[model samples]
Target: MHDPGSSEHNNRIPKPLGEAFLSLLERDQRRMLRICTRLESIADGLPGSGKLRRTAREIAFLDRAFDRHMFIHEKFLFPLVRSLCDSRESVEPMLCQLEAEHATDQGLILEITAAYAGAIGSTPRAVGVPLCTLGYLLRAFFENFRRHAAWEKMLLHPVVKDQFISETPKHQHDAVLRYSIGAGRSGRWFPAVVG
Candidate 1:
């Protein structure tokens, strides 16, 4: 096991893929934080009945951010980490847990969107539901993201660097860059690539 606190660990340089992945994660985290701040401000105003449309638009933006996170983890990050690990025994469980969390988050987003839409369509009863849902979802979203980011920065990143130095080829490094920086260019929006 790597000692996360040691000076050696602190001095270690991340592999290209690991660095790119961290950069993407950091960028998205900042973006989400900004969005959350705006949402909090909006929530403070009590968001009158007339503002349902705007609230719905904000919820849609949240959905987009959440979806981008899922794409990165499910499509790129998790797979690469799993492939490089010696045993799936431990990592698989964490991946499963994280994926389940993603599913729950997506479900909450759908619920909130539906409520927001209903409210916008003039059903006053539906308005409160989205506000309550967003409150819960935001808490879960931020907590999960914070924990995951710390774990990656403290544990997985160093391990990935060690593994990459030991096993990866030059072409694989280039491939990592392409996947991290170049994938999903046209209509598909990547949170990291977007802002």
Candidate 2:
């Protein structure tokens, strides 16, 4: 495969643009994992549906942060790499896989959310739906997503960054916005949750 950002290549992204974007995206992912891990630990022990309900609500509150983080990547980062990439053979498939994973992740989250909601509310057990299903879905999502995110960061990020840096940074338009939690703003950088 052609190396876009290698010293032997001309298509390398401007180092600052690629690294800057990659760093913040990584940060957002790490923070989100921390939150999710904490929530998982909360729900992992004991057998109380009430605890599940509370945990669901807590996770729901932070769902937007996760959605927004993915949105920015899908909407901005991947497209740039796709269009500018020289070795489409190598990276395009990966980007497509990433996008597909994004969709899969969305579906998994919805399933998890529904299962949690079912566990929380006074639903009919006569329908044969077990509350244990919720626990299963919750655990599945965390286990799966952790590996997926880690793969993206480890394998995909460097390649994308190299491609992004090869291009002249000024001409491209990325709708970059930070995800601030409180009295702050994302502005030109990636999103941040302050709270």
Report the number of the highest-TM-score candidate: 2
Error (Å) of candidate 1 at residue 115 is 1.6
Tell me the tens digit of each residue's lDDT in model 2 across 27-72.
Answer: 8888768766865775575356435456766568547766987876
What CA RMSD would candidate 1 show? 11.1
- Candidate 1: which stretches are off by over 4 Å? 1-15, 49-54, 122-195
Tell me model 2's lDDT, rounded to 2 decimals: 0.63
Clashing pairs in 1: none
The best candidate in terms of lDDT:
2
> Which ranges in model 2 have alpha carbons more than 4 Å from their true place?
1-16, 49-54, 122-129, 164-195
lDDT of each: 0.61, 0.63
